[model samples]
Target: MHAAAATAFDATPIGSREAWGWRGRTLSRPVATASGEGWLRLVSAPADKACGKLWEGPQEAERLMPPAVPRPRLRKRLTWTEDEHGYLAELYDEVTAPTVTTHEPILREAPDLNDAWWEGLSTALDAIATVSSDRVAVRQEYLDRAMPQYLGIPIDTTVPAWTTAHGDLHWANLTSPSLSVLDWEGWGVAPAGYDAALLYSYSLLVPDTAAEIRRQLGHILDTPAGRFAELVVITELLQTTTRGDNLGLERALRARLAYLTEG
Candidate 1:
């Protein structure tokens, strides 16, 4: 993949520094492009699973998202085949600011997020929700089944409102000092307040940060749609805990579920 990225982008990958996604499905490295410095990301999938929303999300986001949203800009894309595997290489404008975390979605420590950063996030989220997309990030069927099975809430599973969302808004996908959101491969339609709810859920490990998020997004998080979105996120994380993912957040998540249900 490194060789392919270098050849396709006509750039030299630097050093041993590399970023990898879950199960090594994606790899990102800094490169020296002819225009300037850039980040190269490579995604791989079985040939059968290579054509779908996930495969085309970045390009779609590049086309649809406005400049007001602070995100990495996709520069170019290339695709290739090797055996049963399909590989995609995407080069993006370099973002110098580091991610809020080295890895992991849960925030263990508080980041010095300023008012501007918080305001930018709120504004960007508002902008994102207004866009229309057929891609479904959190399906109603999954919410219907997961909420009852995980949250023990047998109430109507229909989402109160549906809106376009970043779909996977977490600490690792965010940057500080300048506030650039990353990883647009999953942006799509979801329950209203889904992004805020997801960010609030991940911030739970740090109470102050979580409280700040709640405060910044109170207009959304405090509404019925927002509450339902929170429950949906909680349900998903609880289900993942059974798979040994995010075990540290299990207790906090359950407590949150109890609070939400009790309220």
Candidate 2:
């Protein structure tokens, strides 16, 4: 992939594109001569598959980033073709968007994230539930199969209801300092507690903080409805295993197992 990236960089019209992030195999290059610049990126097969292709033919890239906030615009997508039907795939002349951070995300964090953060998040979850319900079912099955044995508890059968979800929500994908979310590639309808579950699962790395946050946000998952939150944790566990990202999978699995067997 490095050789292919080098070759693609050499052949393309852009110059001096640097790489970013672990996944995405993303590259950034200046598109104009001015101080403010445009950028381009290339997505390989694995990322393409992860994002899901709605159409057939050679894998195409979707313009994943939303244009500057407040405006909520979408940039045009750039497509590439395989060279010699093998090895490298390429995209050319892709325009980059401005990197300005909106003040809303920064200001919104403090008050919304205090003790009230969870409540706001729960409200967002409810708003999302009005949009979709797919992840609810997928997550339930994952828990039933993968979590029970490890946790020694039967999977909770009740659905926690539904919502729209970012599908992938984490700190890394979020812009730094301000916390504006990026990479909406997997946005979709989901169960009501989906985002809450994801945030909780990842928060396991800091058990005390996770506990505090969950406690503050307890209303979001109270009672039978909250089982969907557990479903979210198990789903993330299965996702980690499936993607070979075991860093937190074991701990998450153990925690989940404990949760199941405790009562």
Expressed as tens digits, the lDDT of each residue in 1-263 for candidate 2 is 43445343443324655645345444434444233333334454433342332221112112321222211122334344454221223333333433222311111122224444344444544554454233223355655666555444465655556555666555443443232344444555555566666666656655665676578657665555556566655655655666666454566556664664574
User: In lDDT terms, how accurate is model 1?
Assistant: 0.92
lDDT of 2: 0.45
| TM-score to native of every candidate shown | 0.98, 0.59
Give the clash count for each candidate: 0, 6
Please, what are the lDDT tens digits per residue for candidate 1 over residues 72-161? 999999988889998889999999999998779999999998999999999999999998889889998898778889987677888999
- Alpha-carbon error at 57 in model 1, in Å? 0.3
Candidate 1 has a TM-score of 0.98
Instruction: Name the regions of candidate 2 deviating beyond 4 angstroms.
Output: 1-25, 28-41, 46-73, 83-127, 132-152, 156-158, 242-244
CA lDDT scores, all candidates in order: 0.92, 0.45
- Candidate 2's TM-score reads 0.59
